[model samples]
Structure formats: C-alpha cells, structure tokens
Target chain A: MSYCVNCGVELDRTAACCALCGTEVCNPSQPVDMTAPKPFPEEMQPPPPNNRPLIAGLLAALLSLPVLVCLVTNLVFGGGAWSVYPIGGIVLFWVLTAGPLLSRKPRPVPLIALDAFAVLVYLFVIAALGGQGLIVGLHWYLRLALPIVVVVAAATLFPVAYLRRYRADGLVTSAILFVDAGLALVGIELALSFFAGHPFQLSWSWIVLISCLAMSVALLIIDRSPHLLAELRRRLHV
Target chain B: MSPLRKKSRPATAYAEWFKLDNAAKLYPAIHTGKRASMFRISAVLAEPVRPELLQAALEEVLPRFPAYAVRLHSGLFWHYFGHAPGCPRVLPDIKNPMLRPRFREKPGFLFRVFHYERRIAVEFFHALADASGVLVFLKTLVAAYLARAGGPGVAPGRLPETVYGPGLLDPAATPDPEEFEDAFLRYAHLHGPQGYREPKAYHFASTPEPIHTLHMVLGLVPVDRLLEAARRRKVTITEYLAAVYVDTLLEMQRREREVLHVDPRRRPLPVRLQVPVNLRRFFPTKSLRNFSFFVNVSIDAANGDYAFDEILPLVHHRMRLGLDKRTLAASIGQNVKPERSLALRLTPLFLKNLAIAEIYRRVGEPTSSGAMSNLGEVEMPPELADAVERFEFSLGPSFRIRTNVAMASYKGTLAITFSSTCKETDLERGFLTRLVRDGIPVKVESNR
Candidate 1:
C-alpha cells in the first residue's frame, strides 16, 4: 500500500526502501508489511577470495632461493662480506615487487617511501663495498644519493597526496604533476652541483622548468574555460 | 517410476554431445566472473514452491532438453559439450540470481535451477541456449512440477490436452533433432562479406558494484497500457520501448555534458542499442541452440539533441531493416565464415581464444552502448497460466555496458527488469519515471 514519495511508483510491501532511489519509506497510513515474502531470497553469494597474499608469499619464497645460494657461496669461499651487495640487491627487488601485495589496502605514500628507502640502502651497500674508506663512502652517500632519492620521492608523493586529499580533475592533476616535475628537476640539479663543488646555478633545468610552467598555465586556462576545453577535447580526442 | 531413481542409469544412456554453435562460440572466450553471458527466466506460482518436487520435476524434464543437459568441454579448436554425469542439484536462490558458473567446479553444468518461495527460476549460460530456448525449458519444467504437485481438483493423468501448448511440451517424448541443430550454419549464405564495423558508442562512466553483486529493478506495468502506448506511436512495443530507452540515454548524455562536463570529444559517439532478434521468426527453425542475432540501432548525439518522436522512427526503421532475412543471414555468414576457414579450424584453441577476445574488444563491446531484449508476450495454456501468477526474464551483467534491460510479459503484466552493476540508479529512475509520466502505472520491485 505504501509508495515511494520520491519516485511515485508503488513500492513492494516487503521493501523497506525504494529500490531506485534508496529513499526510506515513511508512510504513516500503512506500515511496511514485514511478513510479506521478499521478491528474492536472503542468501547472498560471496565474491571469490583475494589471492594477492598467497601470491606474495610464493614470491617471497622464490626470491629467497638466490639469496640463500649467494650466502652459502660466500660462506664456503673466503670472501670479505661480498654477499652483502647481491643480497641487498635481491632484498631491494623483493621490496619493490612484492611489498604492495602483502597489504590488503595499499597506502601509496608509505609504499613509495619504503621503495625509496630500499633504493637508498642498496646504493649505500654498493658505496660501502667500494674498497674506499667508510668515511668517504658515507660522505658521498649523504651528499649525493640521499638528496636525489629524497627529491624523487617528494616528486611522486606530492601529487599523490594532492590527488587523495582533493579528488582533482584530469587537467588539475596534470598541472600539479607538471609543477612537481619542475621542482624535482631543480632539486636534482642543486644536489648534482653541490656534489661536484660547482656554484648552485640553473642550467638546462631552466628550459624544462619554463616549458612545464607554460604547459601548466595553458592547461589551467583550458580547464577554467568551458568553450576552450570543449575545443581542445574535440581536436585531441582519441 | 520416481525420476530421482532414474539417475542411476548407465553412462551410455546419456552420451550425446554438441559443438559450440556459431552464436555461442564467442561466449566462452569473452565471459568473466564479473561479466557472465547469462540470463534468467522465472515463473512465480500461486503457492509456495516445494523444493523436493521442483528437483524431481527438473530431473524428469531435463532429459527432454539434451542441449541443456551437457557440461562444457574444451577441444583443440573450440569448446564443446559432453554429457554431464549427474543431475544438477536444485539450490536455494540467492539474492543475486546469476553468478557466473565456474565450469571447472563441481556439478560442471552450464545451467542452474533455483527455488525461492513461490518462484522457480532457471539461469542459463548463453552457450547453452538463448532466451527463447530457455523459456521453453522453463515452461516445461514448471509444467512438470505442477503435474507432480497436483493442485486441488486436478488429477495428474487427467490434465487437459490444452495444457501441453506450444511452450509446454511432453516430458516423455523424445527431443526433436532439429531442436539442437545450429540454425545459423544452416541458414547462412557463405557468399556474404565479413563483418561490418560501426563507430564506437557512448558508455556510461559510473562506479561499479562489488564483484558478484548485481542490482536489479523490476518495473511491472499492465500489458494493455504498454500496447496502447505503442499503438498510438504507430510502432510495436519493442520499437516504442527502444526509442524511449535511446531518448533516455540521450538525455543522460546531455546532462553529463551540461552538469558533469564530460570531454566533448565523446559527443560524436552514438547512443546505440543492441536489440537481439529471434531468427526463428525470420526463418522457420525448431533448433533450440543459439539462433539469435542482435541489431545495432543508434542515434548520433553530435548531430543534435533528439526529441522522443524523432528517435522513434529512426529506431523503428533501423530495426525493420536490420531484421530483414537478407541482412540477418549476411550477419550470420559473417560470424560463421570464420568457423569454416581451414586455417582457423587448424589453429589451437588457445590461439583462437586470444584472437576472438581481441576481435570482441575492438568490434563487439565498443559498438553498443547497451542492450535491450524483449522476450515478447509469453503464452501458457489456461491451466498453467492460472496456476502461474507472473513470469520474469533478466539479462546478466555485461563486460563493458553497465546496464541492460530485459522484458517479459505474462498474464497481463509486463515486467521490465534492468540488471546493472553500476552504483548509480539514475538511468533506471529516469526510464521508469518517464513511463509513469506517460500514464502507465508501474509497481517497482527490487533485489537491491
């Protein structure tokens, strides 16, 4: 006897809410008939279970095989901590490939940060094993590699954070990405110049920065103006 | 003899097998858990359905449908069918009717029978049968159940002769050989050219429901009101409804442009519908295997905004032209010619699967915005009709198209069911509200 006030169609007596709009029934004249049989049964079919964790576990076991062989060879042969390089490389690869699969809901920020940390550790292992003094290796690592990795991670994480915080449109996303790229290039150049003992000055990075800025501005303009956006879409459609 | 005891028959008793028909060849390659090529037909009786009786009825009537009695088997070049070993257990119906059948699992059957309250439904994988064939199977199954249940004042043996009408066949009779033949291969003229391509169609961009969850909304309308509305428009019910669907889609596209600001480049894509035509009407064939083809009727949104009136004739004429025997046969030839090619026949099943999947991606899924299938009015003998309250038909989820419509009318009520995987109900609301405005009363039901 009750009808959805929103859709104006008679609702089935068994329905507590309108199927189309999900509007709750609130008719005072007639209450929902709880005893009426539903159109469908109550049993629900569950979806197929997730297989990512099992795959990740298998990958972990497969990856450990090479690591084990390298360790055994290092132990049998009288090598001086040489296995650290190969072992570090394998660990880094595993983290990059299988890390996301381990978690049910992957948070991009932490995963990317972990990946950056792995790369830094692998590079440090290589530098430490360079036969150079530990002091020298540590010096270069802090001066050059650390800053570069930090810059790349920042470049990736900034856009992701912005996207997650405010679900931006495609044009806005592209604009933010362009700006992030420009800044990352500047940071990389500064780290390189400082490492080589040259004065911090913009070189080819200026061209990339200028180009990215111009593209970002143009995209923003198109995004703001409907007519221009429509025109661009028509011409550039796939 | 109890049909359940008949299950102990020797394996030799059910040895017949079949090839995947021309129209059926595409389903096994393209179907996925999310997008199963499945459909359902259900009949609600006046009284609660007894599970034990329904199960026995299925066993008795299933022998009459040899095409539906087998399990899918893979061969070198194509997937075929072999006789399934045991009777498929009748399960309690789920809120979501048709979950894609995992053929490797137990009961390896292509179809399932389910009972919920008064309703007895059968869900079929498209490779088994089209809606027309499934309807016949369902009708016979229900008839058998009724005979066993024996309603008041009715005796099983003394049932009227009229009870076995065109739809309900005798379960004791042997199945006609013509019933399982591939009608497409028989009717196709191989001289026709290969497939024709159309511009890509517009698709709704909406969030999808979780896997295995399908949202169905049924709008029940009086058949007389719908027929009268179609008559006023000088078109058949199918034509009128399709035009309305196209118009609704066009309006949704317009709203997307004005409100959501969709990229204008997509404006050129047409709002096309794939309306499945039962070829049995065009060419006389008793073959129950897949003998149906779809006609793509569309309106280009870039041309201009179209009123409902303008869309009607365009859809009507396009349907008439597409349903012609020559056009349909040519389309059938386009599909069947590949099966006949010596090189293709020699190719491994794995390679053919890849090629077919790619072709469907390029030429099939993109060509239609959505699909609408009208099973037309279902006719049952008076005895069964009075016992059965209503009948419903619904299409399963599609790979690309988010929403699809299926219409089946029985006894004076027409049930227009929209099966969708999208989270948004805007399309269903727009469609049903439009009908309500046109003076047809609709009572809404759902498995939300």
Candidate 2:
C-alpha cells in the first residue's frame, strides 16, 4: 500500500500525487498505480445554450406588435397622431416589466428611476395628443406627475434601503408604514392643490392624516410598553 | 425465461403519460437552475463503454421506465407528467453531472444518460425518483448492455428485472397502477408532526468556489472492515459513519471557539445529520418514483461534550425513533396536508412557487449540518455482476448544504463519495483520518 509522505494519509495505489495535498510521490520501490480508475470525466462537454438572446428576441417581437398596430391605425384614421399613445404605452410597459427580466443583476434605483421616466413620457404623450405644446406638457409633467411619483418612489425606496442595511422589528416597521402613509397622503394633496391653482388647503386628507398619526403614536407606545405588547399579541394570537 | 416471453412487450406501449408519484410533487414547484434538486447514480463497467452500444442500451431500456420518460406540465392546482417528444440522448459525460439544468435542455424528460470511459451514469431530477428508484433503472440498463455485448447465459431479449415483480412488463399493468401513485398522500395522516423542524444549526462557512464548480472527494474502503467496526460498536454502518461525522463537526466547532476566545456560557448550536429514509422499506409498493423522507439525528453540544461512543448510541436510537411508521406517515402527512389544503390549492402557481421556495430556504439546509444518504448494497444478476467494477451515488450541491456524503457498496468495496461546494476539506479529512486511526484502511481519490 502507498501512503502520502506529506499528509501521511493513505493514498490510492494508482495516484501519482496525493489527492489531499497535491504532492507528487516518487517512490522507486513502489511505483504509482498507473491504471487506477478515474472518478470524473476529464473532457468537459459544450456548455448549454444561452437563452438570453432568445428571450430578448421574443420580447422584441411581442412588444413591436402593439406599436405597429397603433401606428397603422393612426395613419389610416388620420386622427391627430393618436398612435403615440399605444407606442408610448408599449415602451413604458416593457421598461417596467421586461427591463429587469433581461438583466443578470438589476439595481432597483436605476430601474425605478427608469419606470418613473416612462410614466412621465406616457403622460407627455397624452398632453401632446390634447393639442398642448411642449411647454404645457412639460409644465404638467414637472409640476404634477413627477412630484407625485417621486414621493411614492421615495416612500418605497427609502424603507427598502434602510431594511437592507439593518433588520427592523415588526413594531418598528408598522410604525414606519403608518407615518409614511400619512406623509404620502399629505404630499398627494399638495400636488393636486397645486394643479387646481388653489392655496395649500387641508380637506379630507387632514382627517386621514390625523388617524394615521394616532396609529403611529399608539404603535410606538405599545412598543415601549412590553406588557401591553405581550397582551396584544396574546389577544391576537399572533 | 418463461416470464420474459410472457410479458416482453414495451411498458410504454400501454400509456404515454403518468402522474408525479406521491413524493415527487414538491420538486417541480421549487426547483430552479442553480438549486435544481437532482441526484446521480452511476455504474463502472469492466470494459470501456462504447457510445453506440450505450445509446442502443438506452433505447431498449427507455421504454421500460415509462414513468421516467415523461415531461413535467404544470396544472392549475398540481403538476402532472406528460409524454416528451423524442428519446433522451445518450451524451458524453460532462465534468459536472447533476447540477446542470437538464429540463431546460430537454423540456420534459426528467433524467439523462451519460457515458465516460468505462463508467456509465444517469442523473435524475429528484422529481424523477429517489436513489433506490434510479438504481433499479441503471442496473437494468447495464444488464441489457452487457447482454447485448454477449455475457455468458445472458440474452439481450431478457434484461434483468427488479425483484419487485412481473407486473413491470405486462401491457395491461397500467389498469391497476400502484407504483406511480403518490404513496405519501395515499397513507398520509395527522398522527404526528407534518415534517421535521429544528432550530437553525451552524453552517460551515468558506470562501465560495467558482460558480458551478463542485469539489468531490471519494474514499474507497473494504466493506468487511467497516462492517466489523460497526459490529463492534453494536450499531449499523450508517449510524457509525453519522457518529464520526457529528464528532468531526464538534471538534471543528470547539477549535473555532478556542481560537476566537468565545465564552463557554454561549449555547453551541446542535449538530444534526439529515438521514434520508427510503419509505419503500416501510410501505409496500413496486413503484420506482420518489418514496422517501428524512429523519434528522442531532447532537446538541449545549449540554456538554460527547465522546464517539456517546454519539453512536444517540444516532442509533434517534434513527430508530425517526423511522417509526406513524412518525414517517405524519411527516408525509405534513407535506401532503399542505397540498390538500383548500387555501394552498387555490393559490396561483406563481404564488405557490414563491411560498414553497421561501419556506425551503428557511427550513431546508439550515436545520441540518449535512446529509448522508446510504444507498446500501447494490446487487445484480451473477452474469452481469461479473462485468461491473463499482457503483457510486452523488447528490448535487444544495442551497445550504455545502458538503454531503453518498455511499453504496458493490462487490467487496464500500464507496464513500463526498460532494462539496466549499474549498475546505476539514470534514472529509477528519472523518477519513478517524477511520484510519480506528484501523480501517482507506484509499482516497478525488476529482480535482
């Protein structure tokens, strides 16, 4: 029997080198077993076909159909370039869905920013179809839709970014949710009032906002008082 | 000879489809490209395998395993097997066998055939069948090939069949199919816990190897010496090996703690080995589909240090208790009960997949330090057995299990093959060296 001189572990009679340490054995008295059975195949097979290109081709084919149909309809009907609506819609939809699927690793910030841009462009198409000039379209997109999407996206992205760095307990997460909901509601009202050409006036949003604030305070109090939290958990059987 | 002539017709001539057997339903739901649940069972022949002959043997044997020929089709509430288009090709053996996504290449076929030099191997997605199920298929294929190659007293017309019964060959056997039925669902009851659950155990962390590069270390030893050692310990070979494995992990843990100067008051995680039990032994059925579950044997280090002797009895007793019929049925019930739930059944396929994958991630590998599947003795007809050199079993890397062992004995050699996705060789080295210290000679091999 042959043994690995370096590690002192028993070596297969056929091994030229130690399987564990890769030290070549040079024994004149006991030659290596040259014809031992190999455990794995030496030759590697051709890699499997990469289907990314196929997926891209299929997506392109499916996405083009709607734009082509809409472009044809607009030309035939001669109705104020209405084709832009479906064209923009299709492009916007692809950005939101297929864009992430096409990538090996997707960073959420860039993808979400692209989605927000797509929404603005789609709205711009509507504004242009309304016979508004570039100035009016820009005004509505910049003043209304852009601000609302930004707040909504921030509401999502900030929490995700925070949670990614550190885990939050259930109570902390619920508290954040309640406060974020109230802030989002307030932001929506401000943006709408700006569009209506009215001063910052709180209406039904105040009542909902107050309720959200109260919920957040209650959750905080329960978090601080462990006994109350335990009692609640028992009652809810959570 | 009488049986061969009486029922020699193709098994598939009767049906082109089948249902995913009881133990196979969960695989289709959670399987992915990276974490594909697949296992490989291979046989080494006395002569180099000819590609054409292996292909011919596959063509002959493919019709016999009709259950393995179908492709997976997702239904609203469940997944079913449908007939694949053409025959699965017998390809050249690849470096990595089981981890590659075979279903994507051959959309419906659940198993693949590969030949490398003198070795002929088949890798089956866990959805296809357990190791026991695949072994019979592989043995039959090898038998047919040897017969065609002109083995003594063996004829190509009569391939060696499983001892399960003659219902395998009859074309009318499909009328009362029992093997393809999900035995788990058939015998599921709420008598015990649905599945084994435990607190997450410690994982062996390491510098991750390159993607798709799994390191394998194989140790070959005489079956007699190991059996004698087990006899001395008054435990089975599996129990003995598991004890050695747990002891190795404990040693590693103690070393890590000593180096880091960690407090003794801190609770050390339990070291558990997930032993897959072949339900076929407890339940009677001839079906070759997946009919197995796992019994987790654990040693909690929080109490105190355990010697090798202490761990062996603990593993033996735990294994006996875990194999209880009612307990196994309850475990089966745990899995099937979820499938039977109205809420889960009504959930959309995509949602169900998400839920299942999440649960598997949390509860699957973290609960076990490693898995050791003992395929037991491999037997073949005397004529065909003479033409075979050895048999090996390999399980692909799991999401959390970085290292695992698969063992099978043929002739006088017991092959213990370790499939690992990590760079460290501590666990394998420790286990083998302990055997050597105990006076069992080991001949180590590797696929570096």
Interface CA RMSD of each prediction in angstroms: 1.0, 2.5
Return the lDDT, model 1, position A48. 62
lDDT of 1 at A210: 87
**lDDT (Cα, tens digit) per residue for candidate 1, span B200-245:** 7888768988778888899999999988999999999999889989
C-alpha displacement of B389 in model 1, angstroms? Answer: 1.3
TM-scores for all predictions: 0.77, 0.82
Model 1 TM-score (2 dp)? 0.77
C-alpha-based local distance difference test score of model 1: 0.85
The digit string of per-residue lDDT tens for model 1 on A39-141 reads 8787898876767778888988998999999999999996688888888988898899887887667589889989999999898888788788788898789
Count the clashes in each prediction: 0, 4
What is the Cα-based lDDT of residue B389 in candidate 2?
Answer: 88
Candidate 1 off by > 4 Å:
A22-29, A55-238, B1-17, B152-166, B262-268
